[model samples]
Each structure stands twice: as structure tokens, then as C-alpha cells.
Target chain A: MQKKSRGGIFVISAPSGAGKTTICKKILSRNANIKQSVSFTTRKPRKGEKNGEDYYFVAQKTFQQMISRNEFIEWAEVHGNFYGTSRKKFEGLVSSGFDVILDIDTQGARQIRNSFSEGVFIFILPPSIKVLRERLQDRKSNTKKDMQRRLKRAAVEIKDYNMYDYVIVNDILGDSVKKLEAIITARRMSSDRVDPKWIKDNFLR
Target chain B: MQKKSRGGIFVISAPSGAGKTTICKKILSRNANIKQSVSFTTRKPRKGEKNGEDYYFVAQKTFQQMISRNEFIEWAEVHGNFYGTSRKKFEGLVSSGFDVILDIDTQGARQIRNSFSEGVFIFILPPSIKVLRERLQDRKSNTKKDMQRRLKRAAVEIKDYNMYDYVIVNDILGDSVKKLEAIITARRMSSDRVDPKWIKDNFLR
Candidate 1:
């Protein structure tokens, strides 16, 4: 008996305001076979957020315990709150042949790369630094100092784009979504993912 | 000053009756930036086949002269007729940033692979062996013996599918076309092809 082909993991990272979230959401809506890996977070859910759907909202104690038990594939502390992706959940999705998309930051993407080298790492770039700054300013909540700090961090993160396999400039939302979808579709058709048994049965026989 | 990104070479190969020609035609028609590499052939052009469009029809002497001059990137003699691709033309197209698609057979593909290692090699498969046999039979010129020989050759060629970067089973015409388009788009977005100066100007500074 031949082993089944495992699904691929697509890791997408971007600096803030690069529109990675919107592109990922569009991809998920169009592709039923692709699932988003909902993270576990100790941060309190905002309005309309659902536990286990948006995130596995757990208390800080539970998050710490899970980290201590080594259950998280990659976990990080951000803004004084913990966010993690469950190793069990991720492996389960992939083993069952469902493509999983992880929308993460550059740091989280780095950790995932260390653990899962097979994953397709993609970096999303805002059209320009000026555009990114304008988008951040439009958020209405960030103070001047906060905006400057975020911009600095974004510049630092953008330098890591070279580490990724593919990069998409988020100038237009629809175009970026299509490019993301293309990446997912093309990755599905890679020769490495084709089942040897299927090839034998269809052509060799 | 940053160097311009060169265009990619997409090499597509398939067994006889696998519908590679039709798929390539559709891709060329839809994509304006892509140009087909018209091969130089010593064989007489069939009815309705234009000299430069379908192929570059040349005399056997001319073909041999060009071969001696080392102008052909790859060439092969089959059934007393010679076919070759121009290395200079291909490089010119790529340098001008126009993606070039070469539709060749498995043997020709293998030869090109040795010369152009950076090309994206894609193999197209029929829905199944049964479908391939039927397609060959549908060709009115093929005798029973010819059909059988073609089927045998196809089986041999199919094994080379593993060597390709991407594989598409031509089960549905529309689906296969989309997959091919996706591969091309995703490849264009690869980090290797990105202009570093654009990154530095737009994000770093």
C-alpha cells in the first residue's frame, strides 16, 4: 500500500499594514480545501471574535502550561500577550491532506521555518513605505509615537523578505489575492507532491 | 543602479496525445508577455503551417551549418529530419524580459535541461493511459501498428514526468490552463527574481 500524499503548509508573513490578512481571507473564502490555522492566544478577544474559530482564547496560565508541555509548534509573546500555534492541530490538518495557511509575522514565520522547512514561505510587501505609513496612520488608534515605532519595526521586518520563497507586493488587494491563490494552486501541482502510486497506476500500467 | 530581472524560460514536455500542444497554444494566446520559441526544422511544413509562426522551416544544409556554428541551444534528428532551437533568440527574448515557452518532446526537453538549468520544466499527462490510447487512435493517419508503437513510447516518456518541476494531469482543459497560469505567475513573484533596488527604495529608505 502506498502512503497518502501529505498536504503543504503555506506560511505568509508581512509587516503591519501590508494587507496580508485581507489576501489570506480572500484565498480562504475561495478555496474550501485550504484551511487557516487558528492560533491559540492569551490576548482577550475583541468584538465579534469567537473562541476556537478566531483563536483558541486561553488564559495566560493555560498558554504557559501548553508552552511548558511543548505542545505549541511556535509561540511568541507580543505586546505582553502570548500567541501560539498548536503543533497537534497543525500536524493533524496536514496529515489529513488539507492545505493549511498560516498568517504570521516575520518572527513567527522564522520560528515556523526552523520547525517546518517544507513550508512555502511568502512575504507580502506594501507598495511603498509611504503607503504603509499612510495605512498605519489611517488606523485612528495609533498615537504619533506608536506610529513611528511601528514604522521602524516594519522597516526592520521588510529586510527579511529575502528569506522567503516568494514575495507579493500588496499594491492592489484583488491582484495580490490572485497571486496568493496562484501560489497555492501552483504549489499543489508541484512534482514533489504527486503521489507515486497514482503515476504508476495511470501511466506505468 | 539595479540590474533588470531577466524573464523566465518555461519548458513544457509531454508524451504524444497528451494535449500539450493545445494547452500551450491556449496559454500563448492569453498571455501577451509570453512568446513561443519557434523551432528550426528541416522537415517540410504541413498544410496551413506558416514558416515562422509554426516553425522556422530551413533547408537541411542550413540546419547542419547552424549546428556546426553552435547556434542551437539544443537539437535532435528524428526520422531523417532535424529540429533545433536558436540559443541566441532565446537569450535575447529572456534578456528583454519576455517569458519564453518551449514546447518540446521528452528527449528534446532532456537536452535543453542540461543547457538551461534555470528553466521551469513542466510535464503534462493525459487523464490516464486509456485516454492517451484513445487520443492516439482518434488521429486518422495512425495505423494500428503506429498507434501501438506510440502508446509504448508514451509509457516510456511518462516516466520522465518525475524530472519536471511541475506536473499537471490534463483531465479538464480549463483547470489545467489555470494551473499553468498559476505556475507562471507564482514563478514571476519568486524572491530570486525581485529587484533589490526596488526593495531598498520602497521599503528600506
Candidate 2:
């Protein structure tokens, strides 16, 4: 019998209002073998957010201690709130042969790239800047000034699309989800991931 | 509008009895934009083979003259017959933005790899050597000696699977076809293949 191979890490990054969350959710719903990586955050959970399921809500002091001990594979502070992915958890899941999907910003993705070279990096883009502006405007959760700031941040983030292995223009939700799923399926069949011993045992003899 | 990008070359190589020819035919029938690259050969046409559709049949003298003129991308002498692919035709199809699939042996695939660095190489393997032997036995076209020779050749070719970008074990035809299709779809979304000008015009600006 062939030994099960280690799982793959798929990191997805997108600018605000690119519909990445929706695409990720759709992919997770369709694939039973893939699991989402829940991040550890110092920020308090909003209403209906479950611990360990949504985010592992940790005290600021505990987050700082974890950072000092070098427990994070990638971590960053946004709006003075600490957020990080645990190295132990990620490695454990991968070693157990469970593919993990991480939905993070470019900053966190960069850190992950530095620490783990095998991760597949994917970037999502809105169909156009005009579409992005309209989507942000429709949210109503942000003030005009905040919306403008988000648009500026998106412009900067979209420039980093070149760093990713795959790019998905989120013009339609279903199409983008299919593309994302294809990437995962194709990556699994990569020759580098196949076990040479298994090939030798089955085909050579 | 985005200028049409140059097309991609997909090369599939497999040992005998791996079902690669069937898979390639299915893929070509399903995809409207993909074309098969016909080879030029000095061998006589079989009962149902056509001149241009199956192969560009040529005299030994003409094949030698074309080789002297550097017209072929890759050529080889097999069983005292010359077979080659036209460099002009391959480049023309690619430059016209039509994806081309080349169903060739490992020798031709290696030659193409030396000439073109961008081609996607896929290696197909039968489920096991026992299965391969059974399938070759079922053909009954080959004598016992010829079948033995083919089995030996298959052993040598299967070792080259590591040189390919993707490896598909041909245990199930439908599953292997889906994996091959996924590879093509995912490659289209590769960030490196995306036009920078298009991104700048549509999303960045």
C-alpha cells in the first residue's frame, strides 16, 4: 500500500471587496477534504462568532507571548489588533494529510511564503476598479472617508498579484469558484507530489 | 481590450497500453480551441490513415531534404522510417493563439522540451505492470517477441515520469480525463500567463 502524502497549503489573498470570502466559502462547501485555517486573534469576537471556529480569541498578553516564543508561521497587526496563524496547527493538519486553505491579506501571505516555500499562493482581483468602487459603496458599513481609504489599499494590494501562482478575476462568483477548485485539483496531480516508491512498487515490478 | 496571448503547448507521453491516445482524442473532441499537431513521416499509410489528417507522408528524400533545411522541430528514425514535426506549423498555431496538443513518444517529447521551455509535459502510467501486460496481450496484434520488447521499452519510459509536470495514473478513464482537463484550466489562470497590460487597463487604473 502507498503511504498517504502530506497535504498542500493553499493561501489565497485578495484586496477588500474582491469577493474572495464568498469564493472561498463556496469552495469549502464543495470540497469535503479541504479545511479552512482559523486564525488566532487578540481582537474580541463579534456577535455570533464562535471560538476556534471563527477565530481563536486569545488575550493580547497571550498573543504577545506566542509571538515572542516564535509560535506563528505568519502574523501581523492590523488596526492595533494582533492576528496570527499557529505554526503547530498548520503543520499538524498538513502532516495528517488534510489540505488547508488560508484566506489572508498579502502581508500575511508574504510572511507565509518566507517561512513555507511549498504553499500555493493565489490572488483574487475584482473585475475592474469601477466594480470594486461600486461594491465598496454598496456595503454602507464604512463612511465615505473609510471607503476611499479601502479603495486606495486595494490599488496597492492588486499590484502584488504578480507574486501569486494563480490569479482569479472575480467577475462572477461561480466561475471564480470553479477556477479555484481547478487549481487545487491540478496541484494534487503534480509529479513532484507523487511518491516515487509507490510508482516503483506498482509499475516497475 | 486584452491582446490575444500566445497559445500553449501541451505534450502527453505514455508507455504503450496506457490509454493516452484515447484520452487525448476525448480532450480534443471536448475542447473547440485545441488542435492536434500532425507529424510528418516517411512510413507508408495504414489502411485508414490519411495524408494530412493522420500524418504528412513524405518520401525519404524529401524528409532528408527538410531535415537539412532545418524545417522540423524534432525528428527521429524509428524502424528505419523518419518521423518529424514541422516547426513552422507548431509556431504558427501558437502565435495564432490556438492551443496545440502533441501526442508523442518520450523521444519526441524530450526533443520538444529541448527546443521549447514553455510546453506542459504530462506523463501517463498504466495502473500496474501486470495490467499493462494484460492489455498488451489482449491486442493480439503483436507477436510474443514484439510484446516482450514493448514491455521492456515501457519499463524504460515509465522511469522518465519524473521529468513531467503532471503524472496521471490511468486507472480510471473518466477520472484521469477530469484531472487532465483541470490541469489545462488551472494553467490558463496562471498569473504569469495573464497580460500585464490588460490588468493595468481593467483593474489597476
Candidate 3:
């Protein structure tokens, strides 16, 4: 009998402005197996941001109500804003045989891992802390103080690299994408996912 | 720190005349990541068989001595002829980060899996039992009874296809090679081999 397709959740965590969003966009556009998870955030929508597409923007009271109802797979507050993933949405995507990709903070990532022990956790890294500082400064969006704060926080974050399933350095965009794609492709054919019946029926006795 | 390269072993098993060896040859020539694991056998060298390159030919007494010493990874007798894999050679290739491909029988494949639980196993099947019988009959190298015996043996072997990581139906040679390549390529990126350190240091805080 043919086995049914099984889907997994791919949790990709990266420091701010490390190109995780862009890479995820490219992969989702190319890969048929992946579905990106849109998060719900209790923050005012910025100009050009579409609700339910960019994020499910809600008021603080509304987000707290959802939290009280335990509707989220995982949630956390950052910079006075609440961000969370809906458990129902995540389950719907996986049950349909599409691996869901979650772009979230490390705390959220860990929570998801605790809930789904087999979730594929991938961490993205900059080539170096110095390069990261330069990239953040180059963006012209953050103040010098803001850049310094991020770099300092990044040092602490880098220590958790060992907790992930795959670590990719953003030394080059194209190469990093190749490495990520390779990881996803290989994980799909893992021994746990293989059907032993296929082997027993084909190999000579 | 620089991450280690990820590699994997792919064991391909098929009955005689199923074209596994030919497909393996094409696959190795195409994939730079794969290297063939040449087996050691005590069978008398048929005409045109080259020593070391084809099979490591050894005397029956020497083969038995090696078996007693536990020098071979797996050994089995077929038609009073002995075949086995050299453990040292296989280990050396694997430690060097080259994915080794084993073209062997089901028994040998099972032994390899037991010894190397991490290896990816694939089984190849003919399109139908009728096609398998016709292919064996056309070989002309075996007697009619021998051909019938092999055909009967193949049917029993087909029952074990469920034991493999992947199965290829060898109706077309080109498509079969592509399928094998995809499986191997995917196997190399599994989380067990690929390092995740870079991801933690760069991405999550």
C-alpha cells in the first residue's frame, strides 16, 4: 500500500536583518513542500501592511483574550508588542501535507520545540559579529545605540546554536539558500519517514 | 568554528538481472558525492574479471580464516561461492566524508544496516514478475532450471521491499537513475550529519 505523505514544521530563527525573511520568501516561492506560517501580532499595522497577509494585527486586549483562551501554539511579548502563532492554523497546514515554516524569536522557537519535539529547527547566522554590526548600521534604520544593543544581544543568542538541527552562515545569500534547501530535501527522506514495506517488497530474499 | 561536512551511505539491493549494478555505475559517475564500495569475494574469477578492481579474490581457506577472525562486515555463501565486504576499506571511505554506495544482495544489505544503522537503504524492483522472468531467461548464462529458480526467488524477494528507505521501479533506466540520485542527494543533508551550529550563532537571540 502507498503511504500517505507526512508533513513537518520547519522553524527558522534568525537575528533581525539577517535576510531570513527574504530567503523564506524565495524558498516558499520555489518549494512546493513548504508553507509559511503568518503570525498574529498585537501591534498597529504600519503603512502598506495587510492584515492576515503580513500579520494578523490585533489590539492588546484582543491578543490577551486569545492568550487566555489558549489558542496559540506559542506566543511571547517583544518590545511592548505581543506576537504568537495560532495552533489551529499550524495544524491545518501540516495535516494537509505541507511543511510549515515559522519565522519567530528564539523563545517562541523553543516553546514550539517543546510542544512538537520533532520540529526541524534551523538557525541562521551572520558571518561574524562585526559583519552583523556593519549590516545593521548599513541598513540606515537603526541608531548607533540600537546597533550596539543588537550586537550585544546577538552574542548571547549565538551561544544557543548548538540547540538547532542545522546552522547556516549567511556568508553568501545563494550558498546559504543552497545549504538550507539541501537540509530540507534530506530531512524529507529521513529513516523515520521511510516506509519499510517498500524495502521488504523490493529487495531479493 | 567551521562545521563538518555531511555525508551518508546508500545501500542499493536488487536481484541479479534487475540492472542494479548498471544503474549504480551510472549513478556514481554522475554524483561526485558517491563512491562505490568494492566487495571481497572468494568466488573463482570468471573470464574478464579483474582482481581488486572488480572483486578482491581470495582463496576459500583464507576467506574462512577471515570469517573466523571477524574481519569482514558481512559474508554469505551462494552456490558454494563466498562474498563479503572488507570492514577496513568501508570505514576508511566513510571517515573521509565520501558517501559509499554498496551494490549487494538483501542479506548483505541487512548486515550493513545492522552494523551501520545510519546508512540509507534502497531496493530496486522490476516492473512485473513476468518481466523479471523474461529478463532472467534472456540472460542465456544460466540453465532453464536455474533461470526458473532465480525467478521463483525474485518473487520471494519482492515481499521484502517494505524494508527499504526507498524503492525504484526499473521500467526505464534513465528515470531510475534520476530517482536514485534524488534519494542520495537528499540523504546527504539529513540533520544527523549536517551541523547546526552556524544557525544558532547567526540567527536567534
Candidate 4:
């Protein structure tokens, strides 16, 4: 028998303005084997966001109903907007042999890990606070107070870095993308995913 | 504080005449950060085998002395030839921030794993018996009995492939090398190797 392709759930977490979205975009565009998990959000789509493409947009009541139905793998609220990952979709993508990259928050990630403990968690960190401040400035808010508040929150969230399987420092974009790719590739070949019985039946026999 | 460099012990095992030596030579030549763990043997050096370079040729008396002193991390006898790897050399290379790769047999690999559970073990497999047969024909010994014996031993060794952290099918040389490189790169960023306090002290602060 030929070797079977194995897929894994990649849980990628990062603080705000940590350049995770850009890295994820580059990885998804280059490798057809990998795909980003399209999350469901109660908030309206932004100007350029597409429904089902960017997110599965739904009403707050609908999201609550799904949650009650236990449809979500994990869900959390951000700024009063509910966001979640659909369990059915996640399992479907993985079983189809696609590496599913979930760009989710730590809170949601914790919930996912409780249910899907096999997922590989990666944490992205900014090179320095100075660079983080500059990146945050490029966003909608540019005030010093806003930057400080965000930085403080980032420091708090950084404690969970230990929970990740890998950590990438976003100093250079190309290097960070390469690191992410390596982590995914390595995990795909991890012995935990390889069954000795299958090896014996196929190759050894 | 800057991110610290990490070094690990990579234990690589392969069956006889599986093209492991060539792949290992390529990896060593390309990656300067990776160093091979030279083994000491009681067998006399062949035409071009250099002392300490090819195999650390030693007398039987000296080998036994070292073994009795507990200087060797792992040792085994193959075809009446005593061979061993030094604990001192392995420790020195890793502590110096170099990834130490031990190209040893399954017997030696099992010993190392018992002593150093942190090491990453990788097993290389041939794509097919036809390819392996062709590769074996190119080697110095090509008698029918020898070939059968080697192939039988190879099948037995193939069962240990699951003991490795990763398995690379050596169908295409370039692709296998790339996969090995990715495994090493990803392992460098593994959370078990990264110091959490260092991250908190440097990045978070």
C-alpha cells in the first residue's frame, strides 16, 4: 500500500498587529495542501470582506442557536461580537487531507484544544515593542494611549506562549513564513501520526 | 535578551545499503550547523578511512577500557567489530549549540534513546525493494547469499521505522534532503527547546 497523506489542525495565535494574517496569507497562497479555516462571526462584513469567503456571517441569535446546538468547535466574544469555528467544517477539512490553519484567539484556542487536543498550536511574537508600536500605528488607532493599552494587553496574552507547540518571532516576513512552513511540514511527518501497524502491513510485509 | 540558539541530538537509523550514507553526507556538506557524531570502532581502517575522520580506529583493548569506564553513550558489536559513540563528544557538540546527528544502527539507537530521551530519531526508508536491490548491487559486496541476507536483515530493521520521530522515503534525493532540512528547522523552534522565561524577559518586557 502507498503511504497515506496525513492532515493536522494548525492553531495559530498571535497578539493584535503581530502580522499573523499576512504570514497566513503567504503560506495559503503558496501551498495548495494547506487552507485557512473560514470562521463564523456575528459582526457585519467589513468593506472588502466577502461572506463565506472571509467569514460565515450570521446574526447574534443564530450564533447563539448554533452554540446551543454544540455546532462550534470553539467560540468567544470580542468587543461584543461573537466569533467561532464550526466543528463540522474543521473535521471535514482535516479528514479531506487538508492542513487546516485556524487563526484564532487564545481563548478560543484553549476551548479547541480541550476538544481537539491533537491540533498543533503556534504562537507568533513581534520582534520588539518598538516595531509592534509602529505596526499598531498603521492600524485604525494611532494614539499613544491606544498603543500602550494594546501593548499591555499583548504582554498579558504573551504568557500563553508556553502552551504553543512552536513560536515564531516575526522579525522578517520571509523567514517567519519559512518557519511556519517547516513547523507544519515537520508535524505532518511526526511519529505520533505514523502507525507502526500500517508500516508493517504495507512496507515491511 | 535575544532569542537563544538551541541544539538537539538527532539520531538517524537506516537499513543496510539504503543510501543513508549519501544523504547524510549531503546534509553535512550543506548545513554547517549540523555535525555528525563520529563513532569509534575496533575494526582496522580500510584503504582510505582516516582516524577520527572516517571512524575513530582503536584497538580492542582501548575500546574495552572505554566501555568499562562508562565513556561511551552506546556501544554494540556487529560482525565481531566493536563500535561505540562517546557521551563526551555528543554532549560537547550540543552544548556548543550544534545539532548533533548520530548515524548509527538500530541497536545503538535504542541505547541512545534510553539514555537521552530528548533526542529526535529519524528513519530513512527505500521507495521499493527494486530500488533497494539496485542500490545494493552497486555496493562492493554483491553475492546472492550476501544480498539475501542483507535484504532479510533490512526487512527486520524496517520494523523499527516507527521508533523514529520522522520517516523519509528516499525515492528522490533532492526531495528527501529538503524534508530532512524542514524537520531540523521546525525542531529548532519546538516549544520544549524554547525557554519561556527568556521569551517573557526579552519579548514581553
Task: Encode model 1's per-residue lDDT on B1-96: one tens digit a residue.
Answer: 123557888999888899988998999999999988899999999878999899999999999999999999888775467889899988888889
TM-score of 2: 0.95
lDDT of 3 by residue, B1-205 (tens): 3434434778888776787988998997887868888888888888878998789999999999989989888887765688888888877777777888887778888898888888888888777666777788787778988887787667666666657776677889997887777676555444455344554443444
DockQ of 3: 0.23
**Runs off by more than 4 Å, candidate 2:** A1-3, B1-3
Question: Tens digits of per-residue lDDT for model 2 on B57-97?
Answer: 99999999999999988887764678888999888888888
> Which docking category, incorrect, acceptable, medium or high, applies to candidate 4?
medium
lDDT of 4 at A135: 95
Native-referenced TM-scores of chain A, all candidate models: 0.92, 0.93, 0.89, 0.91
Runs of candidate 1 exceeding 4 Å displacement: A1-5, B1-5
In terms of lDDT, the poorest run of 10 residues in model 2 chain B is: B1-10
The collision pairs in model 4 are: none
TM-scores of the models, in the given order? 0.94, 0.95, 0.79, 0.93
Error of 4 at B98 (Å): 0.7
Error of 1 at B10 (Å): 0.4
- Candidate 1 chain B lowest-lDDT run of ten: B1-10
